[model samples]
Target: MSSLFKEVDYLRIPYADIKAATNNFDIVNMIGIYHSKNVNYYVYEGELFRSGKRINIIVERILGIQEVQLLEGVSVISRFKHNNIPTFVGFCYDKYLGGYLVSECEFMESLEQILNITPNPSIRKSEYRIRENLTCYHMLQICLGVARALSHIHDCHAIHGSFNSYKIFLDKDFEAKVVGLFENPEYFPLTRYTCYVDPESECLNIFLTPKSDVYSFGVVLIDVFCQQHAADQSWHYLEFPEIPEIEYTHFDDNIRKQMNSKARPFC
Candidate 1:
C-alpha cells in the first residue's frame, strides 16, 4: 500500500479554486450532504464550472488526521480507470479550515434510495426515468458491474473498505458505478439497508481480507435478489452460523430463501 502511494500522480487544486467553484460552499449550490457527528469530514455536492464546462463534484471537507490519510488514499484511488467505478477528480488543502478531497459527482440515485422508492436524483431528467423498483435485468447488471469493479480493485491489491447499497449508484440508464473505493475504514459508516459487512470484521483479532469482500458480496447479492433489507436478517447469522462458504452453487438457494413469498410469482 505504501508503494502504491509513492507512484500516484494527482491534480493539486488550490483552496481558492474549490471555493470559487462552489460559491464559498453556498447553501443554494449545495446538492447533497454526507456527514456524521463523530466524523470531522463533511461531504457536500456542488457544480464546478471548469474551462467553461459545468461539472458535478463531491467535495469532502477534511480536518486533522483525515486530511493526511485521505489525501494519501486518494492518490492511489485516483489512478483507477474503470467504467463500473467512480472517477476521482482532485483535492484542495487550506491553511485554516483544512483540506478537501474531490471526486466526480454521481448524478444518479443510490441503490438504497432506489430500493426504498425514494430516489433523489440530481436533475429532473433522471427522476422521470428512474424506476420505482428494480427488475431482474437491472439487478443482474448491478451485480455484474459491482463484481467487475471489485475484481479490478482486488487486482490492484486494494480493498474497497466501504461497499454497500449506498455506495452503489445507478444512472438513468441503470448502469452501476461503485463509489467510496479506497475510503478510510475508520470513517466508514454503518447502514441498515444492507448487512454487507464481513462477519470477521466484527472480531478485533481478525483484519480485513479479500475473502471478507466475498462475504459482503454475498450479502449484497441476497439483498438485491430479495429486494429486502438485510438488517433484520443479519442477527440470524450472529445467533447461529452455518454456511461454511458462499459459492455460485448456493446462489439459487440463498436467493430463494431470502426472497419474500409474495415475490414468488415474479420469480
Candidate 2:
C-alpha cells in the first residue's frame, strides 16, 4: 500500500492512530453510513492529534476498496482546494480491515440528514436533525455552492462520478461541502439512488461525464424545491426519453404559498 502511494503527497495515517481516534470504531462516534458496490462505508466523527494540535475530522472506513482505487481517489482529492469541497487529510489502510479516508469535519451534518431525506429505509437512521424549515433562500445557497464545487472539478478535467444529496455536507451556516468523488462506474448498479443518476448514462452503459453531474444536480434541485424524495418523482420520467419537465405544481406547498406572485414566474 505504501508503494502505491509513494508518489502521492498525502498523510499515510497508521491504523492504530485511526482506531484510537475513532474509539475502536465505536458506534457512538459513527455519524453516517453509505453503501457503494454492495460494501458499507462507515463515517465517524473523531479527533486526531497532529504535532500536539487536535483536529476534528471525519474518518470514512471504506470496506472492499482496491489499493489502486484508493490511490486514485487520494490523488484526485489532493488536487482539490475549493471551500465547497472537504479537505482530504489522509488515508489509513489495514491488511485485514480495509481502507479509511480521513478529512476535516467542519460540517454539522449531511444534506440528507438536515433535509430528513432517506434513499433507503433499511440503511441506518440519522441521529442528527435540524428543527428549522428549509426556505427557498437556503435551498438556493446550497444549489449555488454545489454548482461552484462542480464547476471547479470540471475545470480541473475531473468528473464527480457519485454526486448525490448524501454526498453533500452542510456546515453550521448551511454552506455546502461536496465529497464522495473518484467513484468507479462499475459500482453504479449497486447504488440505491437511481433517481439522481443520469438515465442516458445508465441506458448507454457509458462512462459518467460532467453532464452526469449536472443531471444529478437537477434532481437535487427538485428535491430541495419540492421537499420530496427524487425517487418519488423519478417514476414519472421513466417513460420519457429526455429529462422530464418540472412544473410549478411540483414545488412544495409551503414554498408555493410563500412565493410572491412576481417570484412565481421566475421560479
Candidate 3:
C-alpha cells in the first residue's frame, strides 16, 4: 500500500500544447546550445506570439540509429512519468527539416562542473571558467533518480542501452534527467567514455538490460564519490597521496560520439 505512492505520480502534458508553447516551432526563439551534429535547446517564444512558453527540443540526425532513438527512445522514456526525468514533448518531421524532438525544457548547467566548483586540493585544484555547487545530496539524488528511471524502463522490458554523465542533464533546481530513452534493437555503442564505462560491458555487444544501466550508475556513483572526497571532504587525499585511479572501460562508446558526429547536432 505504501509502495503505491512511488509509481502513481505523473504529469499529463499534451504534445500539441508543447508545440504551441514553442510558437509553431521557430528557430529564432529557440534557446539552444550548439553542438557538432545536433542541437539541444529550449523554446521560449517567437514572432508568432506576444508572450511564449519555454520548452526543450533535440535536433538529431534523420538517419542511422539516431532516427530510431528519436522515435523509439522518446516513446520509451515518455512512457514512465517521473519528476526527475524530463517530460518528453514528442517527435516532429517535415520535408525541410530532418527531425525534431519536443519535450520539457530544463535550464541548468551540468554535473561536469563539479571538477571546478568543488576544489580537490588533493588533486591540486585548478581554477575553472564557471562556478556551481555539487553537494553530496545532489550526487545521491542523481543515483536515486537514475535508478528509479531504469527500474521503470526495466518493468517494460526496455533497456537504456546508452547511459553517461553527459547524457544526464541537470535542471535549474539541480535535478538529474537521463537522456536517450528510445530502444535500438539494431546497435548500441560499447564505449562512450574510457573511464565512465564498465570494464565488462566493453566487450562488443550493446548492453540491453537494466542491470547494465545499473552498472553504469555504479560508475557514476564512483565519480561522484571521488569528487565528494577530494573537494567537499577534508582535503585529506592531498596528504594521503596514492588516490587509486578509476577506469570505466564499459561506458557507451557511441552516445557522445555519434551524438556529435553523424548525429551532427546543429545548434
Candidate 4:
C-alpha cells in the first residue's frame, strides 16, 4: 500500500501497481473492451480486482480526463453510501495509463448478463412478462437497486451522468452496484447516450440524473423480461426499440398471447 493512500482514509493504491498487476495492458489479461459503456473496456485480472493487502481494483479506460475530473468524480462517488452501490474508495493517475477510478471492487455479475441466458425462452413472447410478479422479481430487485443508487447520488447533489447495464453490476448476493459512469470519460459517456443522453452525444448534453436512471432502468426491465439480445453479442437488452415492452400485462397473459408462441422455450 502506498503511504499516500494509507495516510488518506478512503483507499491506498498506486496507478503503476495496477498496470503492472494487469500485465501492463497485456492482451492475455485483457477482458475485452465493453464499448457499450462509452469507454473502452478490458476486464483486467478478471472481474475481481484484489490488490496485495488491500481491496481489488476495477481498472478501466475513461478516454478524457485530468486530475481535476478524477477528483471531482471521487468527491461525488465517495459520498454514495449504499449497499446497492460500490463504496467509492479513491482515484489515481497514470501517465502510462489514463486516469483511473478506484473503488471497493465488488464480486458480482451484471443484471444484463444474468438475464441474457434465461432457462425459459418461451416467456419472451409476451409484453406482460415485465410486470409478472414472479419473473419480474429480478427486474424489481434491479429497479430497487438502481433507485437507491440514483437516490444516493442525488442526495449528495451529484449526477450519475451515465446509466446502463455496463455501468451497473450484480454482486454475488444479487445486489446492483452502479459503476463506471463518471469515472471513464471516453466510454461510459456513450453508455448513457443509448437513452439517458440527448441526441447530441455530449456530456453536458447527457441527462444522467435520477429520472434518467429511471428511464434506463425501464429499458433494462423490458429487456430482462423479453430475453432480447443484440446481434453484436453485447448486453442482453442492447436491442432497445424492438422489444422495450412485454406483449401483455401479466406473465400468464403473455404466455397465451405471444405471437411467437411457437418459438422455442427460453433455454
Candidate 5:
C-alpha cells in the first residue's frame, strides 16, 4: 500500500520504431534533466505510437566502437524486473542512433531534493513542518522500500554500484525506487559530494559489492532519519539537533541499537 499503483510492463522496441515514436529525437518531449554529464544518459518523455501512452524513458547513446559493446552489455539490464528497479521497456542500436537504454521512468524527485529543496527557516515555522508532510512512519517505510529493492537486486547477482540519496526516487505516495544501477565507475569519484559512498570501496579501489551497498544504505538511513534538516554533509559530520524523546523510545530495540547517540549507521 505504501508503493505505487502502476505495474511494470516491458516492451521490446526496434531502433526505427523508437525513432519514429520520438519524431527523430524531438527535444520538446524530454521529461527531466540529464543525471550528469558523466552518466551519458537522458530521460525523454514520449508517447508510444501504438498505444499512445506517455512514457518516461532513459536513453543512452553508445559512442563509436562502443556501440557493439553496449548492445551486448545492455541485454541483461533490459531484462531486469523488480518492484524497486525501473522497468526496462526496450532499447535500440543503429548506425545513426548508436545504442540506447530505455527504461520506465518512475522518478518524481530525488531524496536529495526532499532534504535540500526547502529553505531552512530562520525561526521554527509551523507551515514548513505542516506542509513538508512526511512523518517518522513515512521515513521508516521509505527505508524499508529501499532495503527490499536492494535485497532483490542483490538476489539477482547485481550490486547497485551507486547507492545514495541522490539515486533514490519517490513516487506521489512517497514510495521509494532505486536508480543508477549498472553504474559506470568513471562517475564514482564525482559522487564524493555525498557521504554514502563506502569507505572500504574508496580505500581498496574495488567496485560493486553487496557490503558497499549495505554501507551506503546505512548512510541513506541516517539521511532519511534526519529529514529536511539533512545538510549535504558527510555522515561523520552530520548533526541531529533534536530528537523527540517519545518517538525515539517508541522505535524497536533493533532500530535503537543502530541509531545510538553517536549516529553510527550499521547494516
Candidate 6:
C-alpha cells in the first residue's frame, strides 16, 4: 500500500480515524452507494479531525478490491485541482474492509439526488434543500460548470470514463462538482445507466474517448432540461423511428415555458 501511493501527495489516513469519523459506517451517515461489478462503494458524509481542526468530508468505502487496484484512480484524483472537482482529502485502507477514499465535503447534494432521478433504490433522499425554487438560469449554470470541468480534465490528458448526472454534485450556490473520475470504462457495468453509455462504446466495443464523455454529457443535458432521467426516454428511438430529432416539445413543459425566444433557438 505504501508503494502504491508513494508518488501521490495526499494523506494516508488511519482506518481507525475513518471509522470514528463516520461512526463505524452507521446507516444514518450513508449518503450514496455505487456498484461496479460485485464491488459496492458506500459514500458517507462525516467530519474528521486533523491538526486540531475539524474538516467535513465525504468518505467512499470501496469494497471488494485489492490495494493495488486503487492506485491508478487515486493518483488521477490527486492531480486534479479544479473548482468544479471535489478536493481529495486523503485515503485509508483496512486489511479486512478494503479501501476508503476521502474528499472534502463541499457539495450540498448530488444532481441525481436533487433532481430525484437516481436509479439506485438504496440512495437516501437528499436532506439539503439548497434550491427549492430551481430556475432555468440555475440549470444553465450547472451545465456550464460541468462543461468547464470536462474541458479541464481533457486538457490534463485524462477522461472521466463514466461521466453521468449521478457523478455531478451541487453546492449551495449551485456550483457543480464532478466526482467518480478515472473509472475503467470498459469494465463499467452496463446494467445501470445503459442510456448514458455512448453507442459507439457499447455496440462496437470501442474504448471510451473524450467523445464518449461528450455523448454522456449530452444525455445529462437532456436530463436537466427534461427534469427526468434520460433512460426514461431511451425507448423513443425505437418507438418513433420517423422522428429523427429531439423536437422542442420533448423538453419538460415547465422548463420549455421558461425558455424565451432567444433560448428556443439554441435548444
Compute the lDDT of residue 135 as modeled in candidate 3.
Answer: 44
Ranking by TM-score: 2, 6, 1, 4, 5, 3
lDDT of 1 by residue, 105-216 (tens): 5565557555652344542233454333455656778899999988887787777754666567666677887766364334333321224557556444355566667777
- By lDDT, the better pick of 2 and 6 is 6
Model 3 stretches with alpha carbons more than 4 Å out: 1-66, 93-99, 114-132, 184-195, 204-207, 228-267
Model 4 lowest lDDT segment of ten: 122-131
TM-score of each candidate?
0.66, 0.80, 0.53, 0.61, 0.58, 0.79
lDDT rank order: 6, 2, 1, 5, 4, 3
The C-alpha local distance difference test score for the whole of candidate 1 amounts to 0.59
Q: Give the higher-lDDT candidate: 1 or 2.
A: 2
lDDT of residue 208 for candidate 1: 58
Residue 110 in model 4: lDDT: 42
Local distance difference test, candidate 6: 0.72
The model with the greater lDDT, 2 or 4, is 2
Model 4 TM-score? 0.61
- Summing lDDT over every window of 10 consecutive residues in candidate 1, give the lowest-scoring window: 30-39
Whose lDDT is greatest here?
6
Q: Write the per-residue lDDT of candidate 4 for residues 1-267, one digit (tens) a residue.
A: 344334443553576666675567566543224544334443443232454355654555555445445555665566677887776655566554556655565454445445443233321222222233233345556667777877776676666665655566665555677776443232233333244333334434553345555555665555555554312233334545321222343233443343344632421
TM-score for candidate 2, please give it.
0.80
lDDT of 3 by residue, 1-267 (tens): 233222322322343554465555555433322121223323232211112644344322232224434445555555757765656655554434444544554453445444332332222111332323444455556678777776776776676665555455556565776555446434445423233344456554455456667776776665554542211222222433232345433312333343345555421
TM-score of 1: 0.66
lDDT of 4 at 148: 81
Q: If candidate 6 were superposed on the true structure by all CA atoms, what would the RMSD be? A: 5.4
